[model samples]
Target: MNPLVLPLVLPGVYAPQEDTALLAGALSEEPLPPGADVLDVGTGSGALAIEAARRGTRVTAVDVSWRAVCTARMNAWMAGVPVRIRRGNLFAPVRDRSFDLILTNPPYVPAPTGSRPPRGPARAWDAGGDGRFVLDRICREAPTLLRPGGVLLMVHSALSDPGRTIEHLRGSGLKASVTRRHRIDFGPVLRGRREWLRERGLLSDADEKEELVVVRAELPV
Candidate 1:
């Protein structure tokens, strides 16, 4: 990964990649009211939490990996912000807490024909046997975790089937909307990283290009 790192709302940390810059920018809306509780799901490196905390929102950040939880806490301290980083899968850690804003960057990449991600945190980047597992779960559970009129913001790849996401969210009883989007070339990431796909004969010879969608859904007031 070339020792990739960048200065964020925090300092002195090496992030595994540069994609967080895109995530941070796309999640630019400061959805927290001062004194409001916020939940950051899939707190990879805690960029979203740090940014929200920088604006004075109390944050509870969660991730499946202990390493990710540690990283989020470290980033929060480095940023001179305080965040509660918890270790758990999806929303399991906060089943009892409702928030005014829930921000997530879930693995939405549907598993390609035969490919699967390497076990562990790699799945954080990979969505599923095709990438919608986490997204589907998030949409399905977001309504219950959100306060009335609260919002959920998720960044997902177009490969996750944006249409399906919208439909799923609406079916889950949330009002969904497309808030932002950017096209990302999957060529580099997918080219040399298809072993799992090849193992399952899931990958085609076709080159894959993808769109990244930043969606926001509001729970009814």
Candidate 2:
């Protein structure tokens, strides 16, 4: 299925990129019962939320950046989708809510140690250290937000350790595995941090590409 095209991306908000497209593609193939509840965590431009909404699911999108919240709201409006956009870090805004599906293309770019947590546009992708900063939290928290038989679809770079994500989710009693992977040339962020990544043994000097994987975790009814 073709990835849904976004309507607008405001400055400081993350624009839909390869990771976004990968998650959207996975969402397209997911089984969504009519009126299923869906949550798009760290939703940057409302792309995933709008896509789910188009599929007749009830979508609520959340982001830490107010600019991102505004951008997503506008994009949803432009797409004529009713996505309830909220501003907060991760699932904080939607506490106590459960959903049949959850989608995220969170920040998984490993930043150097001692680097301050990202702000502004950088917050969209600059993850601290091993890049599991946000990913790990999601692994721990997402299961609680999923209804029985619900699924969580998350996209992150292979460098962040998909194995660990799978294990973490499984430890939480959810069945998790990598469902898709796509390799692409390192973007500006990875390219600029190539040396740092190599120092951490997460990347090789000769490697110019990074693999992005979509991890699907399902809750048994």
lDDT of each: 0.72, 0.90
Candidate 2 C-alpha lDDT tens digits along 1-221: 23456768888888888888889889889989889999999998888898899988899999999889899999889888899988998999888899999999999999885457887788889888989889999999999999999999999999999999999999999999999999988889888999989999998878899999999999999
Ten residues in sequence with the least summed lDDT for candidate 1: 1-10
Q: How close is candidate 2 to the true structure, as a TM-score?
A: 0.96
User: Backbone clash tally for model 2?
Assistant: 0
Tens-digit lDDT track for model 1 on 1-221? 12225244222222534345555665565455687788989887887788778777889999887777777877778779989999998899999889988988876655543354446645666666667767778878877999988888887776567788889888878898777777656655565565655565555556355566778888898
Worst 10 residues of 2 by lDDT: 1-10
lDDT of 2: 0.90
Q: Estimate each model's TM-score.
A: 0.82, 0.96
In candidate 2, how many Å is residue 202 off?
0.7
